[model samples]
Target: MGPWQLSVSALAQPDKISHLPLRWIRGSRAVMAFTVSVFLSSILSVITAANPPYPPSTVIRKIVWAPVDTITRKAAGSDNLPVTWADDEAIYTTWGDGWGFEPRVPNKLSMGFARIVGAPGNFTGTNIRSPAEQLGGGRSGRKGWGIISVDGVLYLLMGHADRQGGQAQLAWSHDHARTWTFANWKFLQFGLMGFVNYGKDYKGARDNYIYSYSHDGPLADTPADRFILMRVPKNRITERGSWEFFERIDETGHAVWTSDSKRRGAVFYHTDGCLRSAMTYNAPLHRYLWWQQIPVPKGSADRGDTRFEGGFAVYDAPEPWGPWSTAFYTERWDVGPGEHGDFPAKWMSEDGREIYLVFSGNDSFSVRKATLVLAQKY
Candidate 1:
């Protein structure tokens, strides 16, 4: 038998060792002690493997929020803000379940597009009354959770088209947010999807493929066990067959992809599960930033009123499929960061240190400035 097995077997039969030579007995005791140490270490190794520490992010050290100048210009109950920088040096976004912008729309809409022009500190939003926009209320009303601009074409990833949040489809607009054409095919598997945005018209993209992330669930409001990633050629976003899912991270730390959606693997995990998120590429820093809602406590009264008071978390990574590190986290905040949050690429400073976060805080369109604290390099 192997030494470890022999030592274990010897310990189980104490009577057999009682008659051994004095010197030999002493030697056996030494071996037994060594064996026990090894045994305990093996068990501890397994335990540590199952529960690893939070991975340290090599890029961002932390994020500092500037609350003094934070801006929240309410548009009378508007929410669900998903924005993308366009080639025309403006941000086109969509709002849900309210009158949009100033001089409010003639009617409340479940989904309406608006164009935001000017700097983050001073900007004006004008509502677009497109014939394609949906008007109504409640969960049955369609809304957009993600939007991106590629090559001057605005693509919006919308959910609840089939009278439920589980069904999602894509719609494209050539004239900014004025009009749109919805794709016939729908995605019933992933409802909450967010595109990895870059500079205006996707100018700072790392590759030709466009990447997107979603909770591994069918419902938009519900959290999933983990996050799933998908990608398609930048030119072929409308082609269902051209899309690929992240299957696994290879040994070299690079992501492996598969055409079969069923074989997809998780790219990241969170204690509270994955929910609606906003991801953007920090061009100057060469990192990807992901912002997610920190869900309200399950049994708390605030759970029902997260619009005014809630929490959020921000993570940064070298790539989209990340070894993510926390840039900021809060279990709860006085003024909730809102259910939907995004950092538009246009407002980022040249060094990528100063930026603005746009969210639906206080149940309206909100903007807050934040400075990135980069990790010091020796």
Candidate 2:
């Protein structure tokens, strides 16, 4: 809770260690002194292998900043606009730094790529590549973003992050992650709105198409849970008017789909909305893994003035949009006294069992390694 008060060493739960062999336990404690992140990750790796009665959980390890953060020295300038997606050889992400959602900031948002120096499959050694630079896609602003790679092509699903009154744009990159085609005439529509704010949750090449989701609300509003689902044919996303919206089955037990975007209802609904979320297709568990920030309630309505505050929660579903169940949650863990905690699905293990939960707020990029266990059926 409260800025940086969360100690990494304390993240280990003794109960979870009870089943470990004594020698292994002793070795893990030895790692407590310095390599907290590594030790926690190793332990959880074993825990997941054990098939614990819960979705894997987390062991927060450390706090870090994108090397670029050292230069900007300001939260609003760099690494703040977060949307992550990945390819097999590398984990890729694009962010909005010094871009604006307000009139003064410009309608088109500038974007930058998050750089990681290491080679493929070695995710542990990653740190933000210093000195952020603009990418081809960053030339304009977007909201509800998601990215996927197919046959060496990176496709970014971008929508309006502001009230610009635009639809989702598809950006493409060939020649190995160099640059991209920012926007096309085609866009996604749901309930009379085109900029559904997607990139927060997406699954590429599933069910013969690229499945994605969007939420209806402003950025600052958390617990804002109405989500609409959409899909586009693989490799055909650039074609205007080719996208399809999710239509729930009617009470009469018949599947229905209407060309009218206004008639589309939210595929998944929640009482309160989660501000930011990440969606991943976990190969190990064969399920859709989603992580989101549950905002802290405001004022006496909650317990005093607790504003801009939130924590993390992970959910699992049979598909990208439906029948979701909680896999992990830290209701009391505060990534934000004034900020939010999030998951970059691309940074997760292939099995979908573990990931690094990144926290942003008060000018810091803190991270904790987390995972899912099968705990209690949810």
Candidate 3:
């Protein structure tokens, strides 16, 4: 089917009430209104109960302008980087073709590095790798790109291309950055080049669940394709993993997944190309979904361009898969000097409290921390 064909007719319509009587409708209308209101309220309550929003217990902390030790000062290089804080330390990955400012540099390689910081209060950085060491000799070994942390473990997702083929791989670090377990790195199926992005919701004090997104098939150029959501079981690692596939979009799209901390835990993915995102909570609204097409702000540089950097959406659901409410959609802030290209985003902390947005353009990259504070309603 086409991209916009997600079965959206299931959502209830209140406009149907207009067909009722006009004059005699006062008393009858009051009773009917109460009935409809009660029915709709019941449905909303069920949805909220199934996919509640994140609790206040999940505190959000912001870390900005975190210092970076120059791994390589190439006049022709761009610093399009991605960063994540795990185990009380911050990890960064840089990617780009050696160009403008940093050109003639010999070891023209993209790289990934880790730094162990004491805390947000203690922001001193330590260099984890050097340019000569990161370059190596591969043509497509540009650099590591995607970074995320789950259950105290660090994961890096990146791609490399050679005469053989190009594929994305996953690497894990157990003891922070001191060591890494890069064994059977799961490569993306041939022709697919992207990394898995993740999200989580906390239950009680120490329990929670994580979800990751990845896909297989028609490659980059194809328009009609579906992305798969793999719900990573708590503390388990293996390909015998359980995953579900959402219907394919007729074109490329971007999504942000968040978990609702209720029963079965709901997951909501906001897909861009289709101008809508779908939510998979329980069995009833299981098929029930909600979405809103946020237009690019007028007169902004992103007016006609859907690919503008830094555009992101975070949803609040009373339960997991949701009838979620849009918190806010903001224009891309130039984290980099000029244009910071957008990359996949991840929740820095649980409960949609804080979002870590990563963007890269040309040679420069940056990560911004956004908190979902109560937006002042006019």
User: lDDT at 215 for candidate 1?
Assistant: 87
Tell me how candidate 1 scores on lDDT: 0.76
For model 2, residues 1-378, the per-residue Cα lDDT tens digits are 321233444334433332232222243342231223223434543444222212233221222323322221122333333434444445455444333211123322345444332322233322232222333332134432455655556666554433342345567777334656765364434211211211223343354566666665433232344666666676676765666666754443233455456765554444353345556555555566565555454443432112234455566554564444445555544434223334555555665556555444432333556545453433
| Clash tally for model 1 | 0
Q: How well does model 3 score by local distance difference test?
A: 0.34
Per-candidate local distance difference test:
0.76, 0.44, 0.34
Q: Once superposed on the true structure, which residue ranges of model 3 sit more than 4 Å away at CA? A: 1-80, 91-106, 116-125, 130-139, 142-145, 150-152, 160-166, 183-209, 215-227, 238-358, 365-378
Of 1 and 2, which scores higher on TM-score?
Answer: 1
Give the alpha carbon lDDT tens digit for every residue of 91-152 in model 1. Answer: 98999988889889888899999999988878999988898888766658898899999999
Candidate 2 regions off by >4 Å? 1-77, 80-88, 98-110, 117-144, 161-167, 186-205, 217-225, 250-258, 296-308, 330-332, 337-352, 359-366, 376-378
lDDT of 3 at 96: 38
The alpha-carbon deviation from the true structure for residue 11 of candidate 1, after best TM-score superposition, in angstroms, is: 31
In model 1, which runs have C-alpha deviations exceeding 4 angstroms? 1-53, 299-305
Task: Give the lDDT of residue 196 in candidate 2.
Answer: 20
Question: What digit string (tens of lDDT, one per residue) describes model 3 on residues 32-142?
Answer: 433333244344334443221211111111213233332112223444344454544354344434421222334454554535233222233343433222453333344
